[model samples]
Target: MTAALAVRNLGRDHGGGQAPALDGLNLDVPAGSCLALVGPSGSGKTTALRLVAGLEVPDRGDVLLDGRSVVALPPERRGVSMVFQRPLLFPHLDVLDNVAFSARVAGASRRAARAAAAPFLDLVQMGGYTTRRPGQLSGGQEQRVALARALAARPRVLLLDEAFTGLDVALREDMHELLHQLRAVLEPTVVLVTHDHAEAAALADSVAVLSGGRLLQHGDAGRIYTRPASVTVSRLLGGRNEVPGVVVGGEHRSALGRLRLPTDVAVPDGPAVLLVRQEAVVVTGPDAPGADAAGTVLAVRAAGARRALTVEVVSPGGAAVQVHAETSPGQVFTRGERVGLRLPSSAVSAVPPEDAGTEEPEIADRRTADAGRMPRTHRVASPAVPDAGVRPDAPGAPRRRNHHGDHGT
Candidate 1:
């Protein structure tokens, strides 16, 4: 299939204390496909989208549409539509008028614009809301109208920048479903910028992970999440239970024990870190066969649908490892209870320790340039897992962890 949008060697630099927001990025969005850009706040995911929307231009590289260059096109001339984080609707306009705004701006007569927008309003399940003004509509309703407006223009591509931020879960799901359905019917290329994993899992055909102004990995959502290219990508995609260990005998040696690896990945022996998704790190009884016990319970808390058990590793020098599994909070044990922690080789991705953060709350950088020439293997453990140290002030931000033996809450 021809890509609806193609970006090549895209580089946008805003000189400051910080590096370029995007550095030599390349991506392809297939026609009728939805791609989700996910990363930390400063990763430059939004900047890429804006560049495509013609809201900003790249200092280097080009943007293409249907295999043709559109880098020089103006926002309106490029035939692209964008919905910002907030629904910037005109309060005085009724729902239909709000949705028809774009078509009208494009010189469609009022009657023609409204006629063109009616079917789209119905498409978003907001058909009857046409007469209500923006002030009378709820947040979700306003967003749907905004979506309708964007679609009414019948652009070649649609850009959504954190478009569902303020809505509740149910509403967010509804909007996600609406976008999926519209993708098939309208067949516009879709690019969504979001920090929400579940949103990316639900809506995207592919996931592009960015960090510190560079793309870390891009592939089908399931593959990218299950087997990340780097430890940074794994952590960003909600994988927890990172274990610091060494590579020996063609396997990864963690405090829990050594597990054989499938790929060498050229990671040298000695100090290294292995990343395991919480779902993959199962909890077995202390005496269970294959149990590579290491830690004692520190704390356990209710984690939404499951329990988050925080344990302090007594072995490998006492850093903490937070493990989440299918257990009840009511089944909690007191601190200092001996427990067996097992990380099956298939469950963990052995990455260089250099990719792991030294402290909590620090953003991971994916840029290969300027990385340390020497990879060190330290005998360290996190007092609390990096993510657990996330300040309450920064929601959805990365936290810190000690690698020695301290696990996090």
Candidate 2:
């Protein structure tokens, strides 16, 4: 099947000695499927979305829609619709008028536009709020209308730029469910840009990871989370237990202990990194016979349904490895208690070091010492929409600008 959208060698350079916002980027979104772009700020997620939306032309490469080149097409003529972080609804228009705005722009009469938009508003659970103006609606309500507006346009492709950001957890989850239900009904090709990994995993069939203006890896959510291509990707996907180790035969020798490598992982006999999910580290008393490693509990904290334990284990070579383990709520352990850790071999995978000589013993020792106080996750303020490196009045295209920076991905 042909891809609904194809970005081929897309590149964009923001002049004045700044790095290229996007470099040699390429991606394909299969027809009727949702693909998410996730990465850190200034990683070119918005730049890529703008290029596909025809809001910014790429400095190099072409965009294809339905197997046809759309490089010369304008955003309005490309059969695409984009929803920004803010609703961007017209203040003068009520929810119904705002949703019908797209249909009206496409040449439908006002009566016909409202009639066409009714189903979409209802589709997003905003039928009762049709008469309410944007100012009268809550943030979530306004966003629902925004989605209704985008869908009412009858777009063949829908682009969502962190459309769910800034909402409370409960509302955000509601929107996710709404998005999935709408996708099943409308079947439009979707490309979502998000900084939230959980949102991407929940909404997209596949995810493409970007960093430093480059594509690192692209695969299904499960594969991307479990078998990331690099340490950067692993960390971005929330892999907190990264242990530097060496491949010995088919097993990996790490500071935690020796673990059998997954049969599918093909790494040469050399230094590598072992990624273990925090949930996989089973904790038991020191006397547990099958424990592969033993550690002293530095701290234990209750986190909702699970208990989290910080452990410091010494390898046979005397190198220290700090690991975090989660156990059932019923199990309790005190600080300074000895515990045995079972690092399941099946839950471990080997990846090459991000750089040569970056996994030395000294580095591991330092990390082990510092791991106790590190935050569970790191977060940065989302970046603003990056400049496309193209002038607003570049020939036939009129200048358009969004001040909010890119919201998510």
lDDT of residue 354 for candidate 1: 55
Instruction: List candidate 2 stretches off by more than 4 Å.
Output: 1-3, 284-291, 301-304, 328-332, 356-409
Show the colliding residue pairs in model 2: 384-405, 384-406, 385-405, 385-406
What is the C-alpha local distance difference test score of each model? Answer: 0.70, 0.78
Candidate 1, residue 305: how far the Cα is off, in Å:
1.9
Show model 1 residue runs off by greater than 4 Å.
1-3, 16-18, 263-270, 289-294, 313-346, 355-361, 364-409
Across residues 233-343, which tens digit of lDDT does each residue of candidate 2 receive? 776665677788899897888787788888877789999998877777889989898898899998887766888888999977889988888886688889999999887
lDDT string for model 1 (126-171, tens) is: 9999999878889999889878878876778888877887688889
lDDT of 2 at 272: 90
Best by lDDT: 2
Candidate 2 local distance difference test against the native = 0.78
TM-score for all predictions? 0.79, 0.86
